[model samples]
Target: MDKSWIDWADWCSKPYRAKLEDFLNFAYVNRDPSSRIYCPCRKCENRKFFEKVIVRQHLHGNGFWKKYKIWDKHGESRDGADSLHRDEMFMGSDDYMEEDMVKVLNGWTDKSFKDLLDICNESMPEGVNLPNSYYQAQKLTEDLGFTYNTVDACPNSCMLFRNEDINLDQCLICKASRWKEDGCSLVSDLGPGKRKAAKQARYFPLKPRLQRLFMSSKIATLMRWHAEKRTDDGVFRHPADSLAWKDFDKKHPSFSGDIRNVRLGLASDGFNPFRTMNIVHSTWPVILVPYNLPPMMLMKQPFIYLSVLIDGPKGPGDKIDVYLQPLIEELKELWDEGIETFDASSNQMFQMHAALLWTINDFPAYANLSGWNTKGEYACPSCNSETASIWLPNGKKFSYGSSRRFLPYDHKYRKDPRSFNGLREYRRSPTTLSGVDLLTQLQSNGILTEYRREDLQTRQMMGLEKPEKDPLKKRKHNWKKKSIFFELPYWKDNLIRHNLDVMHIEKNVCDNVLETILGVAGKSKDNISSRRDLELMGIREQYHVKRRESGSEYFDPADFEMNNDGKDKFLIALSETRMPDGSASHIARRVRLKDRSISGLKSHDNHILLQQLIPLSIRSSLPKKVVEGLIDLGKFFKVLCSKLNCAADLEEARSRIVVTLCDLEKIFPPSFFDVMEHLPIHLVQEALIAGAVQFRWMYPIERCGE
Candidate 1:
């Protein structure tokens, strides 16, 4: 079709009208005249659909979108050489061709891009051609094979309108209308009226995404990096070097036989999409990282596949399993019945299987994923029901202690009482539960034997029904419900099913130490209440609050507390310190000299401060014992976070951390030892099993979201 009429200045001309009629006939073709087609008006921009008459009226009134020359969405296609040749015409004559095009395309409308192209074509030699507009240029590189399915969900998260419930207008369980209640016109009027869904989840299918990885020759080779190119030395560098990975291979030889088989790590967390504290909304996104790639490229944004996006004004919480239904179903299929993937590097089709090795999340999210409560008494997932916790009445929180039990049986710290909670530690470390032990406990508790056989068997797999509870009965266990991942055949057998985020643990520990030592008003853990807790525990007497004759109480300064001068000097030292560019954000700006406190530190900032700055800055001002403990803590993190670590170093660090925690117990009040401070003890064991912390940590996942 002749598109010269698009360049005509006058829309009223007879020649333009004749060309417009010809274009309309071409667009309509054999279709019904009443059928709606995408409007090419400036206002609509092919987003709105209109009847043929309304579309013609829109084109006449607003003019055809000048850049839509190819008309791909409107049933027109460039044939033969024309289709393949247009992409080359738009290629920029520069080394940074893609970058240059992106710069030109930024904020440009279709007509603006077309006008620029017209200027370029007119100035260039007669034989040269260019892509008519931005849309045409974009089509050349866009992967139309990748798409997301929008599944309507109940506003209350009861069920998704899918499969058996596909045509249902309302939720089967909740009986709530599937369509939005707001009075708005249906989106597409030509078809049976379809209202906007009340709530919807976007599921990017895992099968095609995984297949696309093998379609590229470079990526296809990289997908087998773990098995093919990785060094098999005992040193820990990648997930493949981990004991868990090896154990999985030993158990399932058939799955590991193909180096092309994918191993994936799942990570999820809720973030405020609006990026404001005032907005009371949470949106959860589930991301998957393929561990089959080498360590260098594994966590990069390009390889991070966002499989499911759960839209939320409120987080799904335990009901997140409802949203994970599609992804889990695809994973099940991938594991049982492999997908036929064509490998560009090998030039052959192969059956590809994938298994979710583990999930990575923060403490609160750990509860949602693993169905283990990470709060109250049984807060430690590693320790399970044997978590050593004591209620601090004055501090109004649970203070976790008993690090001495983890120490060697004959270790000197086990005999010393004053250094810890003023009692001898005779108990052994809490028993580590195996997969069989966990299943046995669940069965004995009636979770698997009764609930699984009855409720789970009767209802839909992904249905959101709260487990029945007696109103007056006291809860005896921390197990919320069996995790959705356990439905997978091999979930229970995996050594590590869920991971503890080292990033959050480091940040919390840093905050506690920094705030308490500096005595940052309300933020300090060593407040009046903490001193009273020490008095209640009948330990650390010198640090207890003393009553004055005037009926006011004054607490004695602990060894960790810094005087005003010390605080000033410490703050000033941190403020004056400079780091290499890109090594860290500007730490100087976060230090408040007048306030004598550090503020507005992000997770990575805290990581740098804890690992590098605090040990250096506090040595001059703090007591020798306090400084030594802080330094040991810092060194523990520095070694644990190393890119390459040996088993001997981790084993030694494990014993060293026990002594560090014992020393800290002597210095800081009992209230200082929250779950975060004690969690470091278990981190080494996890690292020993999972290899480097980098592969399983939340830093890459959190940064990718940003």
Candidate 2:
């Protein structure tokens, strides 16, 4: 990606800029096929336009407090500068969140972010008037402090999703937009829908040489900007919460040196819980590349596997640099190539997109890189719309379902009433998670587990219902109609709440122990305090008081041992004793001091005692949280059962307890040995270790050697 190609207008304005203009024109001419050319700046004569407006009867829309502005280094508006996005409880937000976060964290009605975006992006009312361009949208945000933009179906039937101060128009100076006799080409609109889907057209009419232009920096930048969301309402509208955005940014890092390092970018609008987005010059990433880039040339449409770069101010977890490393490197490489590389920068031709695939090679202990359905296993987007597996584009027969969506391929099951628009669209071409990212995914889930143990007490509280038993099962409860308030999807997501069951989910990196009588007695490698046992690990220096009085020095093991003050050993001199882990056996009878000095001690004195350093396995932390949480959780079912109305569901709920107790035992050591006999085998140990963090999550490409 040559730097010269970056500011396309810079060269186009100069008549004699032959070499630069010639190459860029060749790359840009007739290239983009998605009909996404920059649109006309001046609103002139009327032309063909397709528009949509859907009315939403006023529902219980909960209102939020205020929204703040995100500013850049130059003091430009980031998003909604001085305005606020009122948080609505009912209608959408309620369905996605729990009662605790809604009422406790930030008081509101109830709703999910997904549903909120759907409502926010709905067709605008006919009478509402608004600004019509991207910069205008920007200006509206800066001056008016609030804004909204619209999408038109000019030449297409689908609704055009719009935003208030986002990408509504093309860059007027640059060739980001175009003008025509009847209507202007919208190729340049920076809207998420057009830019994200534009890459697909490039592949439709492929060629041998054209591929280089396709691989140009311009294309790379386009992809970088296009990666807006991890999933759900990422296309537009702010995200509902910080947890959702965190998951998004984890996938998209801010930067990397290689392709394998690519992850997803996390983005959200309204009030971001992360707070980074609301500050000055802070950025975030999201990983959600549905497919690779190759298919765009052949298929002529959007495929996943495209990462994006977003300059924050629009939402939380904003900015898209994590996906820009490759593009930036390619540009610098071209700059070094002098005149030979032909200024085909990311702006002109090679713009790229970045995203993170859900399942990669490193995460095999969980699932594959997502595929289509056979039923019962994978999520059928057309059936139940819970997790990300629904839109599995990397599989053999890639497809997407509309409305209650599901792909028609193999490996997943689909049921009605649950699935919705699973096969949303074709992922980027040849899409599959691999290279460096596959390894990173495994490392986070794997090696991280080696360090900390999560207290999953939440799961046992009956707060966590088992992860939906296959999307195919659409059984609804008659209890709600019979007088109960409502039926929850998880009834209780014990596994989600405290995650007491996932004891090793957290990691303990170090351990240290100390005794007054036996100074610096011992330390374990795993203990962070082990260094403290050596004295002040994070500190720079320490002083030894007795050393100065000794005059000869404590460095000499003989002098250091046996009472530096020249008195008899504190433990020795025929002292009283205390029962310990046998180490107290060293208490009397003229014993040598803590330090071993060959010349002054018997053979046993030289032997280092292992008892001082106590090692705790990761699994040891598991049983307590899981067991305790579950024990408390069981009472809820008992109470529900005793109520006389939940006999049937409570009866079935019996198995949940057995399964929970059994899982807890597998990862955690039981308080008793034969106690396992009284319980079911599900609670029995098949192996000492039920699950090991996969290598990829803990160790990916860049970290292979480290």
Best by lDDT: 1
lDDT of 2 by residue, 1-706 (tens): 2333323433233432453334334323333322111111112111111111100000001111112112111122223232112211111223222422344355433344334334533543322223332333335333422222222211111111223313433321122322112235343444444443221000111111123333345553333332432233322111111232333344434422222112221111122334454555422222222221221221122322222222223321101121222333333332232122122332232223222212222111111111122232223211222212222222212121221111232213223221222123322212222223323433343311100112112222323213353222243210000000001111121111100111111111101111211232432111222222222212212221124654643322211112333222333322333336743334244344444211222212211111111111111222355334334333322332121222234334333444443333222111111111121111111001111112112212112211
How accurate locally, in lDDT, is each candidate? 0.82, 0.24
Clashes of each: 0, 162
Question: Which residue runs of candidate 1 sit more than 4 Å off their true CA positions?
Answer: 1-143, 183-194, 448-476
Which residue pairs clash in candidate 1?
none
Alpha-carbon shift of residue 243 in model 2 (angstroms): 31
* Per-residue accuracy of model 1 over 251-308 as CA lDDT, tens digit each: 9999999999999999999998777899898889999999988888979998999999
TM for every model, in the order presented, reads: 0.80, 0.18
How far residue 60's Cα lies from its native spot in candidate 1, in Å, is 49
Q: Judge candidate 1 at residue 325 and give its lDDT.
A: 84
TM-score result, candidate 2: 0.18
